[model samples]
Target chain A: MSFTVEKTIKTCRGKLLKLSHNSAALNCKMVLNVYIPKQFYENASVAKNKIPSIFYLSGLTCTPENCTEKGFIQIQADKYGFAVIYPDTSPRNVTFPKDCKIDPNDWALGEGAGFYLDSDTLENFQMGTYISEELPQSLASSTDLFEDKIDFLKKRSIMGHSMGGMGALNFYLNSFERNSNGYVSCSAFSPVVNPTAVSWGQNAFKLYFKDYEHEGKKLDPTLILKNKDFSDKNLNILISSGDADPFLENQLKPQNLIDVVTKKNIKGIRVNIEPGYDHSYFFVSTFIPEHCEFHAKKLGLINHLIK
Target chain B: MSFTVEKTIKTCRGKLLKLSHNSAALNCKMVLNVYIPKQFYENASVAKNKIPSIFYLSGLTCTPENCTEKGFIQIQADKYGFAVIYPDTSPRNVTFPKDCKIDPNDWALGEGAGFYLDSDTLENFQMGTYISEELPQSLASSTDLFEDKIDFLKKRSIMGHSMGGMGALNFYLNSFERNSNGYVSCSAFSPVVNPTAVSWGQNAFKLYFKDYEHEGKKLDPTLILKNKDFSDKNLNILISSGDADPFLENQLKPQNLIDVVTKKNIKGIRVNIEPGYDHSYFFVSTFIPEHCEFHAKKLGLINHLIK
Candidate 1:
């Protein structure tokens, strides 16, 4: 569970710790950034009110650095007294090249586009299990920063942008639903809602789930939503997309999720279509504070309203 | 004076417009990002108290996009009802090949390292003049968004990080002092207060002022501060530097400015050494809100205290 601290940057009322650890799940070293809020440092007792953490998964062709630098989530984390974990999209140094059905040159299939799912093929990176189970367990157990005071495994929420949005929704509805203490809430920005229907998602799903029995069936949120019993999912799920986003019509068809939710009569689901915004970090950051507040309320970190 | 609108991004209660214009002073095209606060869009009439402007100069090897994305100033601009202008570090597409003293290979001298100053050498980009005088004049005259309603000229102020901090202080103390209507307040985060004494400053000074009449005499803020009379400068000058910044001792030398202010008994000058912060944008963005409030108060944009 040992992780190397690459850099510790001072930001807002907290610190952003860039860490890299050998991942047993991905079978490669993975990098992630964790922002510890000021509340953690201000508390004298190490175990007083364990800080709730929010996992922020990045989109396609993104590393932990992209969202960490551009998302502007640190300030809101500081404001809400919660920790933020920015996980890399994919494993950097993969060893099983021959096991991979997807070509290395493919932008949507290889290293940068993990799609946050465990591949059924020989070239499986186990990103789904890594993000949902292994990563949180490792982070929670690590002695560094007294991880016990950080409720990364239990009292956690998830948020993401674009492809990561799909990952967040899929994880929350399916894999996380099995965990005794899974994510309390979930939110996404300009997310690829119907990934299996889109070309980007189809390409990734075909590459990663080529020879599995279940195939790409288990990974699709649109499919999972109908099958999974979300009775244990108590917190409200929030999704926002930009109307001006170029990919809104073709790739990020958020209306598909809205239709599924409406037809299924899913409770505590809210989808917002923001006008004049685009599919960029700017769009994600503009609405991040609202997501943080929503998650904070569900994580039991804040009982009262924040201005 | 016509400027091309590059991209307009919607961010918290405002829009960030990336623009490029032909700069007569730099003899090259300059790019900048202007953030229009929601207050401007909220105002029904053209005369409902023009929103004040804040100029943000970036550090070495930085473009307008660097600070525009990482600085996190747009939110504060919205909160304070002030517009922000993020100008590029140096001029690009310089047609004059043999017009400079410094080599193109030198990271500290050319291209991204404009040092925010006009050069007497052939390679002179005249960035200092471009930022303080020409850019504002052009932006004010532009009809887009009725740039007229935005106070880019008289009620404007300046803030910067690192090299740009040097630019802000030097310009505020010397070049801006000459303007009948100049900046109202000035602030910096980890600024190079005494440029003439540092390697970064000395290299830029030598390259830009090689064999010139003024030589390095005109560019140094420490020298200019000693010679110039600041009796008319009304706004408070705020400077903050991190103790952990690697360049604090050799390159930044913020203490020199503190010493200068102390020895000179300069009024309304405050210098703070922040603990554990670094030279990264995180450090700059951490303290940017305080600077914005200081500028907002002086600009008369807000009368009451802000939370």
Candidate 2:
């Protein structure tokens, strides 16, 4: 499918480009924002060496704009000299049932919650493949992005908020072995840690995974982490949750992953539970810079500074 | 009328209080968020000394929350030792004709753009007096706010963005002489310089001032400056406009004030037309700290370092 760059501006010491493309992967037109670090613009050879990249996934009902506006990740990315990509959660033209009980505008289900999984039920919801495979490939093929700007050969890190966070974890776990570098690191905020235990996840999983007999086994990150076998790639895992987050005990139980990691003796997982933050972007913005810097260091783009 | 304190929390350095009150001046129920600096909290007597105060008026469709969320003003306020008061634009419950051809949901018209003028036409829109008179009087009378923490006798500074910028300028020029020790400083971003020329201001002013005799007289900061017989009072006016601001040229012509002040020999007006910045909060946040410090020194709260 062909895509066109809409607008590009130099900001935060990087080039931010908004692009639109007709996607067979998404089955509709979609838009995404890509931020190429000044390392690419200033020194073209760094990108051709395939410098490390990070993908930022946004939460439910949000568009590519939210992360750009409130996430405050660009500043950190600029400091770390890493490329950042933000993909919209879903395509346009998909209509939910009016009596679907879930209001279409509720932001949790219909639009912004792609959940980072391949949908076998909904005709249009093949976003998992689009993000993990096709979109990355497209980004790699485009000289404007990859030739001298991004080092496709380098390791990559993924992180997101709410649904996007769940998507990041699921994508990392599912595709951990495909890339030669393996999954470098992954993190999430207010993620649906145990999808089988929550209402939003339940409704979304039912819509996307319908008749898959491996239902409980497939979408749950904890279950996947336990059952999937792979060489320990030295993945640095960071998870932050707000104790005061209204959904922490219910939808976003960080304890689920903690329990599994403890049983499995996973070595490098770091979980920081904050005291009084909430589920809003205010909470996310406060910590997102740290996450970006964490991944940037793991991917070998920047040295971590002890502040 | 009686008012109730809704909530208060001790932030890292200071206290934040949300108060609800029946505003007889505005003729409606109103809410305000007041942040008292750490100095005032430590020494109660400082507030009664009439220490300098800076009032921040928010733009269209925003409440106290917008400034709190994105403004990044607290750190500067702490450094400068100033109290920050954010008052809502206007009360709800005013009705407009359906054919007014304005989208009621648009942030500019219905909810956020109070225009900071008493509405002679709408029964509910007498917010101008509330902001200019009653609100300040209430702050002065409330011993908890002004007794030892704020020195009303000291010079005052005012600043704002978009509609709020217009409000600050109007209020500063109109009422600065009577209530304030000096118009120490004033600044704005993308302010409606000529209300008679812009759609947002035209619609708001038409509804606010029903009598045509006051046409182009009330809430027109440039007009007030040109026609009113008032001394300059050595007000330190630092006005900035983003050249790339979408509203510039049409609504926020900083040149208007520059042209007037240049001809009138207004000694303290400093106009800065920034290049490439837009109308977003990023632009405001970048320069807001400087403006605060500018006022802090002028108000005698802090001694100016000899440059």
Candidate 3:
């Protein structure tokens, strides 16, 4: 369960660590980036009050490198006292199961397109379990990595971009009422909220599972939001979508989730359609401050000088 | 000449416009990125109050896209109400002239290794003239691009990373007594200050010209600083070098520049050796706000709210 620290680069007021470790959930060695904030460095050994965590799921065809380098989320992570987790979208450098089907050519389906779900067919692509369950359990005991300076069980939020946006929303919705240590808030950027409706999701769902009927309905955010229980869980959800995102009309379909939230009268879910922004990291970096503030409030950070 | 806009993306309080146009100085078509700040969009038509410009030069094997995507300079540019011009390292889509002794295989010799200097051997790579003279003149009449909203000739500062850092320092020093339209200040991150004494600089100088003593001495920052006269010019120079930078000891040689600044009793030039930093955009992005503020003060921009 011990993770190997591959590279540690100093950024902002913290350091971005490139880590690799074995995962029993997905049965492979996994690599991910974790941006440990300035607060941890301020008191590494003194773990009296651990820094809260925020997991940032990257979009399709992306390694942990994309958002870690280009997204500029580190600035916001440091601004708040939250550690940012940049988990890989899919398992890599591992042999796929013989029973499951995969596309070698299509970047939209195979390697980088885990869609943050447990594969109904095989254990090879069980990223939903890996991210939401196994990864957390591993990091809980990862003393060598953080010196127990990060509180992974509590005061955390989930976020993603494009396909990742879908992952964040679905995880936030489905993982609700699990425990008191559940996600405090959720956020996304140009996310595909409805996987059953879009082509990108349809193709990924078709391959990740034998059929969409058995598993897809439970994972789709728009479907879960319809019958979601907000009585106990605080629905502090923030979604930022670029109006100029090319996939907005077809793939993202943020309107689907908005319509459900509207019909059900869901509170505390804000959707801002940013003008002239695109699906690039430029858009994500632009709205990062606002998103950080959104999560920081839910995480109960009282900052006057910074955020 | 007319410029073609490849793409325009909204970020922060501004838009990053990817522009391509013909450069007579480099004898080819060139592509550059310009981040037009929010002040321009506030009233683009009102050319009365033109926005000051900052030209950011990139390092080895980098296009204009590298810094634009990763540097996060646009955030600072928007904060201070100044446009950032990301010019190409060298001329693109052009045929190389005969007898210029260009190494097609070496990235350090040709193409990206313009080193911001006029070639003694050929007109094919006259980047020194392109950046300092021709680029400014073209932008002056570029109504279609900026609509005279950018004060290209006046209120401008030059800054860069790695090799581009060396270029910025040299250009600031050489172009000091040109006119009232000269650069107001200069700054860099992990720059090759003493290029004449380093392998990276020595290799680039030999290939860019027929001899080192004749051309290299003129283009080198360390050489220029020795015989420099800062009588009337405002010597607002800032250099940030990382102690952990792999190239710091052998290549950058900041000690060379420090010696001259110390013995010559130069003022207003501050060199900061940042601990635990490296030669990546992570370092540059982290320090971008400080650099922007340094340039803003030189360009006479007073922003109590932001920079």
Best prediction by TM-score? 3
lDDT per residue for candidate 2 within A94-132, as digits (tens), equals 765554454666676766777777777666777777887
lDDT of 3: 0.85
Ranking, DockQ, top scorer first:
3, 1, 2
Candidate 1 vs 3: which has more TM-score: 3
Better of 2 and 3 by DockQ: 3
Model 1 Cα shift for residue A201 (angstroms): 1.1
Off by over 4 Å in 3: A44-47, A96-101, A177-181, A303-307, B44-48, B93-105, B177-180, B303-307
Interface RMSD of 1: 1.0
For each candidate in the order shown, give its overall lDDT on alpha carbons: 0.82, 0.72, 0.85
**Candidate 3 structure quality by residue, lDDT tens digits, A1-307:** 7789999999999999999999887788899999998888876433566788999999999999999889898888777788999999888877777765666888898788999988867667889888888887788789878877788777688899988998988888877645434688899999998889989988888887887766888878888877666755557899999999998898999899899889888888899998788898999989888998888888877453342
Docking class for candidate 2: incorrect
DockQ of candidates 1 onward, in order?
A: 0.81, 0.18, 0.83
* lDDT of candidate 1 over A79-105, digit per residue (tens): 778889999998876665564566667
lDDT of 1 by residue, B1-307 (tens): 7889988888888898989888888877778899998878875733667878999999888998888888888888888888899999988866544544556677776788888887877444788788888999898889675557888888889998899998888778774557555688899989988888889988877777765336555666677777776767664689999999999999998778778777887788888999999999888888888888888888886763355
> Residues B121-162, candidate 2, lDDT per residue (tens digit)?
666676677876677667777885455457433356778888
Each candidate structure's TM-score, on Cα atoms with residue i matched to residue i, is: 0.95, 0.81, 0.96
User: Which structure among the candidates has the greatest lDDT?
Assistant: 3
